[model samples]
Target: MRHLLLSTAALLAAALPVLAQEAATALPETIVTATRVPTALERVPASITIITRQQIEERGHATLAEALSAVPGLRLAPSGGPGQQASVFLRGNSSRSVLVLLDGVPLNDPSEANGAFNFGNDLLFDVERIEVLRGPASSLYGSAAVGGVVNLVTRRAASRPFAPYGELAGGTQGTVRGGLGATGTIGAFDYLASANGLRTDGFNATARRFRNTLNERDGLQAGALALRLGWTPMEGTRVEGTLRYRQNRFDLDSVPRDDPNSTGDDRRLMGQLRAETRLLDGLWTTGFRVAFTQDRRAYVNLPDARSTASTRDHYRGERLGFDWGNTLRLPGLGFATDGALNFGVTHAREEVFSLAGNTPFQTRVNAAQDSTAGHIALQYRLWNRMDVTAGLRHDAVGSFTGATTWRAGVVYHVPELGARLRASGGSGFNAPSLFQRFGTIGTAFRGNPNLRPERSLGYELGGELDLPLFGRPDFATLGATWFQSRVRDLIIFQGTSVANVDRANLQGVELTLAVRPAPWLSAELGWTITDATDARTRRPLPRRPEHVISATARLTPLPGLVIAPQLQFTGRSPEGPFASYRDDGTSFTTERRNKTGTLFNITASYVVREGITAFVEGRNLGNSRWEPVNGFQTPGRSLLVGTRFGF
Candidate 1:
């Protein structure tokens, strides 16, 4: 695998120009997450993936897990179903180290043990696009960005007349899904509104290998609504407000056993307001943004065969944040000119109230934290062939010591060869969760008041090339990157307490290819090879898959029709908490690594009318019922049919 990655990298360096135009008229792809501003794809110095609405609809991606599962350097572990708790691991870092943003609003739950974002419950019907920027980005985004950042940009109000859309689908296991929305502009005011829901009577979530007797269906019901209003009084001057609400309930399955009565509910409300304008004839721009979010969680578990205990839990968490940003631009002013300089300051307050006992008045695990940070960055292009970027940031969280981070990147273009060479290095940090810093349990377990934030240093070297294959100019594209990172001050549980204990070292390589051998045939391939280990013990990190591969092919045999087939392969991983059972089949241990697996999926769509389309989706077509985490069962084969209307 290592040799293959190197060979692929070599091949990529000899391919076509990354910015070569298909016909000299195609516009370059622009992105915002990489540099906190709109920048051309070839001009950014980061490993980033942009999934547009067109791509999402073409592939029929419905959930965050399905959309991200194919990313080269990303891994998603869904506990059981679409609504179960799903953790994201980017480039071998912990899920807590990855920051998630919904339309510029932070979505990490402050009450979660690791302050991580739940990837399972989100419905993407209102999303316009998703931007995934890989590698350390604390220099720009602060905490929870030690691994990477994901920004889900919501759909915007169209500048044209009002346009309405709807979708409805039904499938196996008594599942149903639907969405409705409209976007348009009237005079100076523009508006967007959308509502979506999904429900499924899921399959039994007990691994057959674990001897499943209780085959109760684990299911989920989820719904969300999104609305936005904007006033574009003039060019370069705009004000906007957005509101979103999501609610979900999902059944849970016990590990190493089946629990028929365990279930959970989660709800979130989020709001944001922002205004921006250009000054000095577009040479300077300024913006202010503010957001508030609330998350509520409740769970109940009756006595199961695994334990003779019944429990009830609930948590409430809130976050409020404000930001002011400015950008100055000067083209051809100096050797390192033609780009913009950006500076920003942000402040956020997070509060959490959690009770895990049988009653609402149970013992408390409540706390709050505040973080204020400022950052400045410079991005320039030297003669339109070299792209350079640098940034520095400092964050002060509550009473803890300060954290400072910095990042630098450079991309050198070889336009004649259609190739670009890129390199970037950065430092990042993840602040301790509120529960880690202030929560306590009746004298037996005390929170670590002195716990420090986890810190990491990472770097990546990469290149991209245009594929001039088969006498076709820019017929395809290939890219490769080698990355490494070191994370220190990992938090670990010591039976009764938690402490910042070890360090981790991770290294990986990613190779990607996008090819269009024919007008009607297109495909993409991604492969990753990773090595993650404990800095001190040199043992493989838990749950880090060593090899992952994803492939997708799109076939369009006729106009207004598309058929796509996708596959994902995950390698064996090292898992923990080894358990042994006696001959009586009573009280077996739990938490172990799952076997490697490959899953199959396909989607077919056809336009029935000018503004209406019908589609069918097939997931887990092979019935691979594989597990990403031991004791957590994945769904089997299922089929769904739906229609989309737009007029």
Candidate 2:
């Protein structure tokens, strides 16, 4: 591997400066899911990645796919371990093309069949950061944002009055977890609340060498709750409200038939109410939102023994949404310099219900859809170092036909040649799920109410540089990006209906580097290279994987202690374990190529002051059995110990 990336970039460039003080708390200088407002990340021309809650508490991240595993053009594809069933693929699209949110609701899964949204069973314990917006946002989030968008902001309020927090833990297949919270600022009322729970005794994704190992063991349970409130009645105006809930259950097996009576149960609830206002003096701003969501899932398989009659399934997806936005500050229609103008509108209504076989529940699905949208955008800054943006959107679902999307961007900077640049282009769409248009599974799988609604055209380009390494001066940084996309009617699953793949193409390349060089050192590295094809049978496009790498480091010698380490790499691609006696079972499948894996982890913490802390966590520490899909398998070496608190 190129001499292990040239000795891990010369050991993070010789540990970037040994040691020092003060430099964390800098990854979030402002970002609101890339362009829905609150910008600033160098004018945000797209391609973003932020995740900070003190780096998920110095890296012991639990869920949200382990805090988006290694970021940088994501590519998760779990099928086992840690509450199984996962999928996330950005640069290479498909995971129903990204889009997952909370704090703007919408968690995909309109009866699934590919509306996707599992990211391995969420749970970021009321996250306060996590805003990854990669590309194609459907001109401000309209239909599955097409390979990007993951919000999740929650957790705010705490500048005194009352602030509290907590967490507890235990580990290894008999684990236990916990959480509790409180936050405040009481004069004009500001608050936050939380609760969390977890349970485990897990380990079993079959694949005990596929030697038929299944002595039972596949467990997990979860719980969550949250609340938020705010008010400011006067001045620049503000009002807010939020609520969240979650429940989960797990234990399933059947990959190579490790069937111990499979199972799964899930639930989700969300709510929101918001209001904003700021006129004149603040350059005009307006906002309104009302949201609701509920998702329920169920699965069961008893009486196994190769299907001796016993099966069950159920799913429900619901939604009710509304939004209105505006922001204006146009410097009186003059040439540039911090000018802006943006406005948007949206509406929604969704419903989905489904049921399935073996005790007379026999294949069924009820569907409903209604959506509306409107958008407009523009931003400015010029002469002071370039920056521009533009947007447009139009959507109408339910009766099909009525879609339009657009996007534009620009950015530039050159402070004494430290350099920076960006570019963007867009269009996106995706619609056609409800079990791919009115589900009905008699012949096993069929539903194609005239399909059609999967379009795209994308672009991106980037650059960044900031020299001066060990001696200071912006202490090292480098970045690169390149992306491309093209698609039209690309939805597939043809064995008994469900089609569309007239064309397709996707491209990628991303590279990054960072080295804070002080304040107790920090390191980062990322790489990606993808190609996802199929433009007329060009093949290569199943679990998209053409190389990916990630590295991390954080050290804080002593003071209060901290240590973090991470690494990941994946290569070899192609996968399609079509299950069920293969084609004879009708889903028509074929593809193979899985071999390639590497993962390592580490975490350590200490801080017995300002609200206590103590921790240790290590996961998959090189137990490598490699199998992200084929036959499941992916669990090995675990350890955890925790503690956290705030006051």
Identify the candidate with maximal TM-score: 1
CA-only RMSD, every prediction: 2.8, 24.6
What C-alpha lDDT does candidate 2 achieve relative to the native structure? 0.80
Worst 10 residues of 1 by lDDT: 579-588
- Tens digit of per-residue lDDT, candidate 2, span 1-647: 33443444445334433322222212336787767777788777888988888898788888888889789888898888767788988998888878888875777867776788888887787788888889899888879898889998878899788998988989888888888989988788888999988888778776666544654778889888898889887878989888888888998886665787778888888888989989889998988898988888899888866667677788888888898998888883354677777877888888999887753336777988888989888878788778889889998888866789998989787655565678898989988887787787775776888887898989887766666645676576777777788878987778877887667788777778887789898899999877888789888777778888989889999899999988888887887546422212233256767778888888898998878999998887888877766667777778889888888
Name the TM-score of candidate 2. Answer: 0.33
Q: How close to the true structure is residue 473 of candidate 2, measured as C-alpha lDDT?
A: 68
Q: Judged by lDDT against the true structure, how good is candidate 1?
A: 0.86
Candidate 1 residue-wise lDDT, 361-465, digit = tens:
344578888999999999989976899999999999998768999999999987666677899999999999988877766666667878888999999999877
What are the Cα lDDT values of the candidates?
Answer: 0.86, 0.80
Q: What's the lDDT for residue 136 in model 1?
A: 97
* Residue 407 C-alpha lDDT in model 2: 89
Relative to the true structure, candidate 1 reaches a TM of: 0.95
What local lDDT does model 1 show for residue 456?
96
With candidate 1 superimposed using the best TM-score fit, by how many Å does residue 369's alpha carbon deviate from the native?
1.1
